[model samples]
Target: MNEHQRRLLTAAGLTELRFDAPMSECCTLRAGGTAAALIDVQSIEELRRLLALLTDEEIKFLVIGRGSNLLVTDSGYSGAIIRLKGECNALAVQERGPDFALVKAGAGCALGKLVSWCGGQGLAGLEFLAGIPGSVGGAVRMNAGAWGQETGALLFAIELVDKDGRIRQISVDALRLSYRNLALADGELGSSILTAAWFRLTADEPEQIRSRCAAYLERRKGKQPAGAASAGSFFKNPPGDFAGRLIEAAGLKGASCGAAMISPVHGNFLVNTGDATAADILALAEQVQAEVFARFGIRLEPEVKIIRDESCQ
Candidate 1:
């Protein structure tokens, strides 16, 4: 962002603006350089205003949620980074029927918190996502899922603002949500910022919902590395096959490059053993992919979002 844009944002209720914000603090991978600017919009109005200003100025910007599935490179992004706050983090029950309830959640609300809230309200259908991390907007955008329950299954509608600063509401059917994917009518991803999501969840006993969520959490704890600096699973499961199985079968378990290592417990997880760089992790992931392809004749596709500077080598 330039000096004029910075002044304009400051005058337009954007109080929090940092120059060259640390990208490592924004993601689970904990490896990144810096961004040109990081601006936190505390309300929908603020977000819209900022989006308009950025669009009018033709300044490139990216909206980020909890940053759970992101992997920023050692050489960070040069454009502005936009994050939501305030009303964007709110969650509440909009309507309640005899058998189901309509729950509205802000895009910036943490996915885990929303799940816990739903469990407390005896809402079913989101228990499968008990252990996943990220924000509601991010989850809906990616159609994130676990244990066969995807985000789109419960979604009823979404309010979003497109890249051109136009706000609109779209039904769940309009999202075209598939396995780990959500696309606009134009098939373009990240061209819109989801402001809120509405979900229809069946009313159940709180204990039952909690129990189901606990079981899902237990399963994740048993298979994935706990308290490790990593971006969850590295690769999406291929058709009729699991990426972790292929990685493990290819002898990539416990593999390391610098301080980045494919978790011994789960071959698909790439963990940072302190001082791990993005380059190191990428190198290890590429090596594992090559080995798996050579051994199983299947190429692995990464699920983690990798961010890199265009000028970086």
Candidate 2:
């Protein structure tokens, strides 16, 4: 962002800003170049103000959750990065009926935190998110799921700000989700920011909810690699077929390029052994896709969001 724009942001009550923020620090992949600016957005009001400013000035910006599913390239991002904070991270019961409760969760709330909160409140249906590592907003935007439960399926409504800085609370009918993809029916995925989500979860015994959550976490841990730097899964599962199965069947279970490797424990996971650059991971993923396609005549699509250098893109 330019100096005058920075001054405008400050005057707009959105002051936590850093110029040339390193994306490596922002992403879970632990490797990236830099963002032109990084702003810690503190509230819904602050978010609206910033969005208005960016829209008016024609500045590009991206609202990031926990950055778990993101892979930013070494050449860097050309826009500013906005991280939600304050009211954007709050969670509460919006309404309660006899059989179900509507829960409001800020987009910035950690998925794990929401899961734990659900378990504590005896809310059923979100146990599948036990081990997911992104923010609620990210999860909803990406349609994150496990064990046949997708986040989009449970959400009744979503709050977001459009590209023009208009805040909206759209119905789930406006959300189009399939496999691991989520897009608003309005087609605002590129510029709109998901601010919060409301989920309709049925009531259950707290102990039961917790038990189910634990089981899901256990299954995830037993199957996926633990304590290694990696996105949860690399490829989307094809119809009636698992990506991990194809990857392993193609003999890429323990493949490596530089520090990046397809996990031996789970063929779907691409890991950074220590110093894997973003390019290393992308190259490795591409190799997986090519080999799998060559062997099975099926091309694998990445579930991880690869952030390319805008210059090259």
Candidate 3:
């Protein structure tokens, strides 16, 4: 590590930080190389302090949640990796009115667990998020949605730490959420961190809510490939058309590029059948996009975020 990074690490009281931490162990895809350094921040205060130190040193860092929608390169990241898995998992029903309640969840709270909690409490709006595997912060950033409902729909407001380490509140409208995208600007990219989100949900019959959530979970089980290493749907559905349908039509199902294969069960999903590398996944994805474009004249865009080393061509 550089002198500046070494000094900053010592100053933050995190001298025991992991060097070359395995990226595969932290990600859902179970692939990729290691981070140059992995610092686990377990509290808001620690996170704030760490960010301050990193910013002062001008270190490039990334805030990772559950690592569900990520693809790190085989060569690994050269900068520090900040993770908030255990620390930012607080979730609670903060307030309740006559007909609705305000539920507050930390950014790192599991999206599925939050939905399950809401469903158990007879909350109606979060049933659609029951099976989506991601952290609440990542969900909000991705505007994650399934079965026609999105995270932004229930988000009343979000608490974030700005670049200057100042805590700020941004409302749902300010997010400018679209399909699989949020309003995280370039300046606020890694500098700002999502802390918590307030969700507004209506009171409903518990049995009905449970039934709906169960149905959603069942549907997800039927559609998505389970018990496999994957990053969920690889491509966002093209406007007025489905990416899976296009890929399937192009005869890309079960197509393999090294260890990565377009899932035979779901065309939009690329699964690592053990021993897949980031390069393999990228090649498979590119081939799918190319074949789909050649067949239907529609270009498929990746929903998964690819983080590669600068040295990677």
Candidate 1 TM-score to native: 0.95
lDDT of 3 by residue, 29-143 (tens): 8889888788877777878887787778777787777888999989898778877755578888889988899998989888878887887888779888887778998898888
**Model 3 bad stretches (over 4 Å):** 1-4, 184-190, 311-313
Provide the TM-score for each candidate, comma-separated.
0.95, 0.95, 0.94
Global lDDT of model 3: 0.84
Which residue pairs in candidate 1 have backbone atoms (N, alpha carbon, C) closer than 3 angstroms, thus clashing?
Answer: none
Residue ranges of candidate 2 with Cα displaced over 4 Å:
1-13
How far out, in Å, is residue 210 in model 3? Answer: 1.8
If ranked by lDDT, best first, what sequence of candidates would result? 2, 1, 3
- lDDT at 261, model 2: 93
Higher-ranked by lDDT: 1 or 3: 1
Backbone clashes in candidate 3 total 0
Candidate 3 lDDT score at position 24: 90
Candidate 1 Cα deviation (angstroms), residue 148: 1.4
Residue pair clashes in candidate 3: none
